[model samples]
Target: MSIVDRALNVKEQFLQELKELPYDTHSIKLFKDKYLGRKGLIADLFSSLKDETPQNRPNSGKVLNELRQFATREFEAKTVYIDNQNSKKNIGDHSLPEDPYLIGGIHPLTHTLNEINFIFTKLGFSTVYGPEVDTDFFNFEALNIPKHHPARDMQDTFYVKNGIVLRTHTSNTQIHTMLKNKPPIKIIAPGRVFRNEDISVRSYCLFHQVEGLYVDNNVSFSDLKGVLNYFAREMFGQSVKTRFRPSFFPFTEPSAEMDVSCIFCNQKGCNICKYEGWLEILGCGMVDPEVYKSVEYDYDKWSGYAFGMGIERIAMLKYGVKDIRLFYEGDVRFLGQFI
Candidate 1:
């Protein structure tokens, strides 16, 4: 049919539907949405105006406008009628107690991620993100983890079809960042990473991480220590003592794991600290020369450090949450306490 004929049909159908609409909210909403919503029949009629010939465009537009105005008035009148009908009916007990948990608070993991990002952003690191599902090249090969390297074993990854895998760490963001921007680069990649590990109280197949990177001339292990020490104090408490023990990672040379004294036992042993007086918090080291080679940067001219920490671990420590599973479980009672 022509635009005018279609508009006339729609107008008649709308009037018939509006008059037949029962005195109820549900029917009224359906009538309104069918004719008056953005993608409704009336709107579709308006959109079809471009197909009308130039000579007929003005007349077709006027007809559509009149139809819309009439439909809108009818819809509003029906809505008011339904509202009046609903108001006249009895609503249930007004004196009943309000729901105890009416409002929701931020998830502890999210709060912890924000806290880590805020601390580093204040320290001159801009927050950056990369894909959770990435190729082995960016996820591994670009960070200097070649295919036969034992570092591939460090993170049991979930491989998708055709050699793509869920990223093992947001450290993948480092490769993405350095490729896009030149140095004096400072960024923190806060995102989710996945592993092929078995689920347990302490371990899950998936978790969140904040991977930090800094690159420039003369950046050093000393600079890494100073920034991390300040972060440790800020995140845990002003009195928390931090120490670094030599460790290894494929992407960083001279790597170490950082630990803070157990706050719960007051420097005494506890299960949360694995009966040790210290709790390992994060891993860090000077960026490996191989990493610079992967990104085509001159290792001698540039120096930097990379660090990563799990969001769940930090939330567990900060909130005394023993099970890492609690963060993932949809337990509002457990989550509600954070408020």
Candidate 2:
């Protein structure tokens, strides 16, 4: 046959073989050798061009160049395909089992605060929030903790300039709420509070508190007891026992601390309860007349009750956590237990 015909046959055969090239390193190497190698079809086609007549040589050379270009393009594409497949194989098998992805959870203190909020909200108490930083008027004076009072010593406050302070308790929310809204106000303020204290298993420089306030005509200490009793049962368990012992706070007259029977010991002595079989959970009482007077409320006309509890303290007692520091430390092993 003519030189052009022979080159066309070789080109057609190479193109057909190229179409069947497998995407693998070994198969790609063999494909290169068959079509584009030194002794391959394109090289053999060029070798045959020298045997053609002068007039046939031009057409044969053009056909040979076309075949060379086509073979080169096909070989490069196949080489890239095979290289990518090998690279992916070297990287890893996507189908194999993978290490589990860790899931995140709420911090223990936040979790407890949410639970507290949920309980009180169910009891007709709306959730309220207030500023962390405040003046002595709101944080202390409004709550009947006057300047130079012994009660100020109890808080160990982190005071800022001009008598402003990082609020010692969420109870400041009570003053804010009363001033803005008339009586029949029921609110539970849950937020972070700061104090000047040494860090230890039982105490921290900063912690969370939930302050509850209920005001209206004839609001009584019995109402405070009933609400807190319900809270203790809801928070601890339906069977949890609670008691109120007379305590003192500048804001709440007839102030008392509410204690829950040690869950760890079922009211029997234990290290968790300091072997006393009782753990103080919160402090509460009727709003003192002075607190009402400071807020410009007629103490006789609008009586109320205010209660406050430490969120970290509640979390520790509920979870059997020994160290208060563990709540703040971002240790996965310790925090994961809550989840």
- Model 2 spans > 4 angstroms off: 1-101
Report backbone clashes per prediction.
0, 0
Q: For model 1, where is the 10-residue window of minimal lDDT?
A: 84-93
**Candidate 1's residue-wise lDDT over 170-254, tens digit each?**
9999999999888989999999999999999999999999999999999989999999999999999999999999999988999
lDDT for predicted candidate 1 compared with the true structure: 0.90
Every model's Cα RMSD, please?
18.8, 8.2
Candidate 1 residue-wise lDDT at 31: 74
User: Candidate 2 — what's its lDDT?
Assistant: 0.87
Clashing pairs in 2: none
**Cα-based lDDT for every prediction:** 0.90, 0.87
Please give the TM-score that candidate 1 achieves against the real structure: 0.71
Best prediction by lDDT: 1
Candidate 1 has which clashing residue pairs, if any? none
